[model samples]
Target chain A: MSQAPSDIDDLIDLMARLPGLGPRSARRAVLRLIQKRGKLMQPLAQAMQGVADTARECLQCGNIGSDDLCKICASEKRANGEICVVEDVADLWAMERAGVFGGRYHVLGGTLSALDAIGPEDLRIPALVRRVTEEGINEVILALNATVDGQTTAHYIADELAERCAVTSLAQGVPIGGELDYLDDGTITAALKARKGF
Target chain B: MSQAPSDIDDLIDLMARLPGLGPRSARRAVLRLIQKRGKLMQPLAQAMQGVADTARECLQCGNIGSDDLCKICASEKRANGEICVVEDVADLWAMERAGVFGGRYHVLGGTLSALDAIGPEDLRIPALVRRVTEEGINEVILALNATVDGQTTAHYIADELAERCAVTSLAQGVPIGGELDYLDDGTITAALKARKGF
Candidate 1:
């Protein structure tokens, strides 16, 4: 027929709903899958099934993993008495890729948003609190984004854990290899304010 | 323990191999799939399985379909003598989306490229030649891309099918609604040279 199969069209529709993909990109992706069914599509399908069958949010930190408790939560090496808190799993993954932190993480699920009506109970704040007390955490590092809602959530967490343990946020400054001219006014101001001895 | 599972890593690596997707995008896509495994990832995996189980290239036209003879090849309505030749299935899908072509299509798979060592034999050119005569084709329309290799392949096919049927190529000019300032010199020149009386 002149039109594509309804299933293929449905697949494209679902693909377009992904984070960075639009309808045009989804169409191209479907075509690529069709063309590479044996080499790529089949394998991709199998992998998705594998992940879908096993992937679950960590019971302790809200991180995605195959088990109820993620690898980080289960590992004794990552138990450094310091927990980096992020607003989402993507940020957790980004921190993991950075390979700097030897400690574990706690995902907040999302930032506090008055407009979206997200409250403390909706996130994993209580679990984080319990973890801080039980694990004898020395510090809670707020790795949330610098947006208003992110900061609001971070400040709320800091307030909640202030009496229990030391709390700190990531430093605001010019990024590594960042050009001064390209930096926004807010970033420049933040960097200037947070400046320390070289 | 901190890193993602090998299966997920494999999925991300395979996703990166798709056209238009890089490593970073693939990572984002994989994470999104993990987060939405029940809603998006499961359905996507099922769709892929459905396509993989049934999808096969049309023996006659090289179009991807769920059947031995694609819907177009099987349909009596699409048996019109006009065969629109394209470089790939993506072009076929694009033309289909436009809903202009009512006849059948011949997907060449790829263009004739000497540097890449791609020849007529590598494409479906021989099959196209056979279809032109056997299917009682009245015209062979070359709708290949405007690129050099596409033109070369079109000309080659035209020369081969010249004695069999009426050979024609798609008209080249400034695209409809395309701004004059944005068009390249070659397109403008061709549009000017091909100008007809009002």
Candidate 2:
């Protein structure tokens, strides 16, 4: 087998650099792209170009969008005075997918990690505090991950905004569809402590 | 949570349509792309566009290339009178990656599948015969898959080209690093029957 065409090889190399794709899967994907050049390939290229050109962080909320203010931040309907704070845009997207929260979001970019030397200034924590006061926020929901750093950041933000608004964290428990047999000791303990009347 | 921007959603939707990616992974991939716009996303988009504009099927062997004749078909050094036959361009790429066989290829595009109503005429069997007789081929290596349809196609091709040149197939046995305890009955039986003097 001779070297694949440079253009196709380049495409495969770049695609392999994506989050989940490896070399073999990238080759498969490139073949699939070549096979469907008229439909999937062209459209995907255009979409990537579009996003690369226009996508930006929401200055107010740190959510990704094409404008300075993300749609969530721009919308009056979403300014329900209740801001759900998250660790990353991916987490914010996950929350949106659940579609349970009626309020807007604040993306902190990352947690406070003293080991990594990441302080509050490194994240969007200052911006979050400013938004709480300026926007007259009534509640700040910490939807950060359950990691130690995540909890630490949540606690730090809670202390900073304790006087300004109500501070709450997502309920800790066993996940939906999770089995007790598979649950870790910490999760089991937390779920037991947070048990409610059925 | 508010609705995500349309462009970002479109990118995620297109990314999800690729093989081995689903909605969740697609979102993660898109976010990563957005984060690394200059380093990865833009280059990927350009590569996609380039491949889409230039990539085509090698008219001679059904392999993918930027020209009518794939590099393998055009290269004189690879004309070793041995043609490896495979079911798809993916299989052809797999053989190339192995870098063992020093010959050209004949991509059948797919196997002879009666259930799917595919036949010899539907595939490149006639093309293979033409290549063998016209190109003065000495051997035809049937490197098709181990599926029922793949074997059936291989036999059909052998019957078609037996009088013209020698015909052979890839050996059937346990794959490399395969554990005997995990081996299926069919693979174990085939490997036992094809045992060599090791």
Q: Best by lDDT, which number?
A: 2
Compose the digit string of candidate 1's lDDT tens values, residues A1-198: 325777787888887877778888888888898888898999988988988898889999998888889989999999999999998887898899889999999999998889999999899899899999999999999999989999999999999999999999999999999999999999999999988999
Candidate 2, residues B47-158, lDDT tens digits: the string is: 9999999999999999998888999999999999999999999888889889898899999889898799998988989999999999999999999899888888988999
Interface RMSD, one decimal, each candidate = 2.6, 2.2
Across A1-198, the per-residue lDDT of candidate 2 in tens digits comes to 225788788888898998899988888888888899999999999999999999999888899988898888888999888999999999998898898899999998899988899999999899888989899999999999999899999999999999999999999999999999999999999999999999
Candidate 1 chain A least-lDDT 10 residues: A1-10
Clashing pairs in 1: A1-B71, A1-B72
Sorted into a CAPRI-style docking class, model 1 comes out as: medium
Q: Candidate 2 chain A vs. true chain A: TM-score?
A: 0.94
